[model samples]
Target: MKIDSRAASRTLAEIGNWRAVLLHGDDAGLIRERARACVRLVGGSTDDPFRVAILDADQHARIEEEAGALSLIGGRRAVWVREVQDSALAGVMAALSLDTDTLLVLEAPGLAARAKLRTTLEGHRSVAVIGCYPEEGRALAGSLSGLFRDASVSIDRDALTWLSSVLGADRGAVRQEVEKLILYAGEGGRLGLDDVQDCIGDSATATLDDATSAAMAGDRVSADTALERALAEGLSPIALARACLSLMTRLGKVMGWMDEGKSRQEALKQLRPPVFFRKAESFGKALERWDRETLARACEAVQGFERACKQTGSPDLALSRRLIAQLCLGPRSFRG
Candidate 1:
């Protein structure tokens, strides 16, 4: 069974007869979070020695054998395998044939489309493959809100939007931040943007908005200041690049909608991860400065820089700072 990360919680609640699950994705944090969530749904605890058995990816034979073993605790039992790969596919397949009395949760890196492990589990009637990918936009915001909602921590819209924009690229980071926010807000406490700002400082000591908006508006001085400050505060170059990518991606869409004659308000409304109301005016300024062709080129440049940063021996921070400076030069500069 193929399940989406958004629907995993619901599916887990009604897991029915399914006993074997494969949770694999590029987002290790999300994979780990969902895998543990599944374990809890099955009435098993990861910390319980008697009810849980942790196995290595290479322990194929052991995985199958232990999964079928009766637990001494005489209640729910589960087998958790970490770092599964193609080599463990055969053993995983064999384990699925055993009883569904005990739950099996396997975690692996994202496999290729033709990978047998993904195929077999996806095809199995009693098996599930919960795909965990890096969530973005409204989905990420909604997930964050849901977590806070579960904790009964009330947060304002602006605060929620800011948190979503800054922290959701990493699931573990999001969880960690949310936990901190919950503690800061306390039970049943109402939280506003200031509370979030005080508790969860933006990466680089400056918001992505400051750097991205300044760059988009072609304010070289502000862009330089923000970029330098953010870097000094320990923000990763890859993270800065990603922030540029995100801004341009949205700006490009909004630019397209404006080209089609839609009102700026209407266009922004259509944007997922809805733009925070306070930032709308600046986003409009960005839209005015960027035409379709220029925005496309900007996106390409940012993406290229991202790839460069990932290469071995690259001076990622310096390269990213230079890119930010170039982008902040605005449309005419890029055109020239």
Candidate 2:
């Protein structure tokens, strides 16, 4: 019962027929959004106390009991379990075996492809497993278009393109920003480039992108300043490290294409969420300065930074600054 993205909506519409639905992926926001959608589809609303039972990882043990409970109001109930872990597999399996009509919705983010819980439930006929990854490129643009269309707001092509490039990092963040844009425009209003820029030009994601791009281009002062602003705006240290890694990964891909005989412009054009025009010169310079081997090492270094930030007692902010400094200084050995 594994569902692809195209079939996800259809499956959710028919969710009442399924015993349980397992939503898993790296995009935690999308997982929660889909989980809420399932809840609303099964029960009338997500906040209905009588028909909706919400459980967290620690309360996973009660999943089965909640799933089997009948509603006093005489309709199907929905039991939502958030942040599910592998330890909850048994309870999930037990819940799926029940004969009741109540729906079970499990939000399990960061599950690997071969994780025991994912593999066990993926093929279950009565369970639906959906992967909720981050949307990018055309998918992201289309999503933004649909959001605006549904809100009855009109967005110009330039605004849509710019928003798509900046907003697809997280679904929940995109939704929040889109809601703001819609409110700013009001119903049946038109949104131009100026409107979106006025609304979200200084978003945290944009700042993080600026920091990573500056660091890649060895602009120490600009990188440090943007990093500071991003941190102050609530961007996490691990997220910053991951953004650096992502930039290196994209640069590495474009370099690979160039090595395969494609012109620099052609290779750069292949990048999803193509390099922002403002940053294109620096991005090209970064491609010229860092060879593939150096980019690989930089990726490793950023991964290590992420790991360090996750450890107890680690000085995350200091480590973040050090990582940015290393990137901007162009060290021969990032391991240092």
Q: Which candidate should be chosen as best, given TM-score against the real structure?
A: 2
TM-score of 2: 0.91
TM values, all candidates: 0.80, 0.91
Query: Best by lDDT, which number?
Result: 2
Model 2 sits at a Cα RMSD from the real structure of 2.3
TM-score for model 1?
0.80
Q: Model 1, range 234-273, lDDT digits (tens) per residue?
A: 6666656667877888888887887899988898888877
Model 1 residue 92 CA deviation in Å = 0.8
Across residues 302-326, which tens digit of lDDT does each residue of candidate 2 receive?
8888778868899999998899898
Q: Which ten residues in a row have the lowest lDDT in candidate 2?
A: 327-336
Per-candidate Cα lDDT values, in order, are 0.77, 0.85
